[model samples]
Target: MNLYQNDDTTIQIDALNMLKLKKNILLKGPTGSGKTKLAETLRHELDRPMHSINCSVDLDAESLLGFKTIEIKGGESVITFVEGPVIQAMKQGHLLYIDEINMAKPETLPILNGVLDFRRTITNPFTGEVITADDNFAVIAAINVGYVGTLPMNEALKNRFVVIDMDYISGETLKNVIRTQTLLEDETLIEQLGKFNKDLITMAEQGQISEEASSIRALLDLCDLTTIMPVERAVKRAIVDKLEDDREQQAIINAMELTF
Candidate 1:
């Protein structure tokens, strides 16, 4: 979480400046644009405890709040309280990160609505206590635009947050990532990979390709593994293989062919 501007000339983030905002901000961008990483960096700078939940189509209110659990202690059935990430965040005053918030079921919005408003409290069904949010509790949700099959967040829930449309990462940032993450420190290769990934991202933006567009994560993961294995094999497994067989995958493979 402690990420400094490793190179002042390249990295754009000033975590201290971001943590100073009064309201919770929704970070919107395309895939692999460093949204989560930025959140982690800011969390460290603010010295805030974090509780994150990755939202998918299946997430529901019960998933957001605490649930009932049965435990066997001394051969006796002991009913225990099991809290979800949201409830835990509320209790600890941690920075709650809901990754891909838009992907959560529409029904879940009502639960979030209560938490987001000034009457910030969550009711634990088991405990029967309407717990209030700690003064320091902050929500940082990340979302993607133009992803098919994702449920659009309801207007009411959206109204609660300050939306910040995030820009695609600059070439220099990619270079910095490459230099730090990849095994080959050759400035030429680092810049080359950055440009290649940038081109892939562009193709995805233009709707010229299918699997989720190449991410900063894809390049970083590739770089991290390439030192221990062949780059081609690493990319094949770490990226191409992970993607579903879709138009995006073809476009990405085509771009890779052109680049390397």
Candidate 2:
């Protein structure tokens, strides 16, 4: 399986060590910085089935734990409690990946407190059954700070895992990622796209553009578009049009012009 590639191996090494110790991990990074990819890499390395939860404001008990539904079995209607990602992970000793965990509602997250802590267990609110995690069960949660619609993770929740800060891959490593991940074949265009990516990231760091506009994922999308469309059109469609603000779109267009 393809793993996360970066100029520095420190993040990957740290994450692997922590996971091997069965410690919970929290991947903190900007959007599209490969937090989920890193989590998947760890899961693959450990050879474990992963159950994922995409946390959002609408996340609730039924989402985290499980829910009851009526089922017709043996010609009779019966109520059964189906397991959710959390419970399934615990019971099956799988890696639990929670993406954008901070996006979940504040009140909804506390249910996992025991599961995340040394207790390694939680009482199913729906079934009144206490569930303890398997020996190999682990949690890997990711959070993107300073994003709209994201809440500050509770201090207690934040303290549960080993936090790894991820940043955008750059330089030759980024160019390599684009070459391998996209359909674009022009070496010159790849180099130009790489430069454009760096400029956008620099602008984001300088607060001239939102990080969303500078995401590597969006950059890859732009690269694929270049295979069939003009670079300018690809830039407009894949990157510029994604931002609602006219100023941001103009900033990206200017940067594209400078790079191409």
Candidate 3:
């Protein structure tokens, strides 16, 4: 859990405090701020089984609760119950992580209200079974603000969980994270990419770019590509190409020119 940042006592303490409360948590942050990574780390630290769902527009009650699938055995057709992540997590006392929860359809989230509040059970309308939540079961969701296709979470859903505001890890910790991920010791390249990422973030914040800010993941991609290609080309393919806007792409090219 401390693998990414050896000395990030702030997040370490915050994570522990959140777990101590044993309440549902919602992590709000900018894209690529390591929100999902934090949730995974919490599950690891707590030693709980983890079930993750990447929330999307298509995810709905049937997809989450359970669905019936037909199975054929010995030429006879039989119906089998297939469990979804949420229910499986509740029954098995695991951590159910909903990544990018705001991307999910509005109708899909009301199911979480009961699971988060004093009412600790979920009913399967399809199966007519009341599934009581286990004490060891918990939920943690991650959301990024201002992302296109994101929905404004309803008030009832917002009231259910204690929210944690997150941002990118500190500069020193980011270097450590890059080192941990790439096992490379090129400090100059590392620093340049970090600064470039910061600049992109600033530009995005200032409404100068419609693309997502460069992330640590993008740096990792650059690291991988540089072993096989030139730094300039790798910067384009692994980082700049992620932006579809021509203007943003040119901006990234200019940034790479200044960095590399």
Candidate 4:
């Protein structure tokens, strides 16, 4: 998917090009700022099969690496390998995407660092055998900044991969995305919504809410779902509610009434 447009912001160009030159990238951004989407786009550019591992507190060393298997159908299948997403990526030299890598357990961080750096190898815990990753194998991690309940990744680990900070797209850029993605008839209404979205984004930046005004993807959802429900209510639920608080919500309600 080409998540970014040719006329879109230039910041993405640097990261997109960097992915081609280097094997490791640490993408840092807010929740809905399109980091993951960009990673997907980069995968297409790299021409490698993509495998994403959603990292969480429960993900540890063994969960990232393969585990041993045993069976008794014919005879004991001791040390038979069952690959994790990382292991599979390594074996095939695909684009390995580690989502929310900072949220991974502390014990998992070191193993990841090893793979990103010169080690390029992991020792199977069960078999005590070391396997080197293919030279073409690459790593890309997307992480959320200022998220709660996430462990602070070790500095040494962070130093290995190049960090790229992604910010929100511009209002005009996002409006284009909304219009292109949605076959909406009322360009005026979309413009109104975009203005409201810009205001909401400013408020969110000031720490007034939990999320941005509304992401481009959210607007696309509004268009996709509007046919299934009332346009007003769909907009309210899909975009307005997430953009504002109770007081702001009531004001938005009054404002929306004027749109009709």
Which ten-residue region of model 4 has the weakest summed lDDT?
1-10
Local lDDT at 178 for model 3: 74
**Tens digits of per-residue lDDT for model 4 on 104-193?**
877667876667787888876656777778877888898887787678887888888888777765566666666666776577767766
> Order of all candidates by TM-score, from best down to worst?
2, 3, 1, 4
**What is the C-alpha lDDT profile of model 3 across 34-80, one tens digit per residue?**
77667767876888888888888999887778798999999999988
Model 4 residue 241 CA deviation (Å) reads 7.4
lDDT of candidate 2 over 1-260, digit per residue (tens):
23354445567777888987878999888986878767876877889999999999889889988899999999999999999999999999999999999899878898899999889999998899999999999999999988889998888888888888888877776776777778988999988888898899988988888988888778889999999999999998988887888888899999988887
| lDDT tens digits, residue span 41-131, model 1 | 6687678989888888888766788688899999999998888888888888888898998898887767777788777787766688898
> Which of the numbered candidates is closest to the native, going by highest lDDT?
2
Candidates 3 and 4 compared by lDDT, better number: 3
How well does candidate 4 match the true structure in TM-score terms?
A: 0.80
**lDDT, residue 42, model 3:** 80
lDDT scores in order: 0.73, 0.86, 0.78, 0.70
Give the range of the ten consecutive residues with the poorest summed lDDT in model 3: 1-10
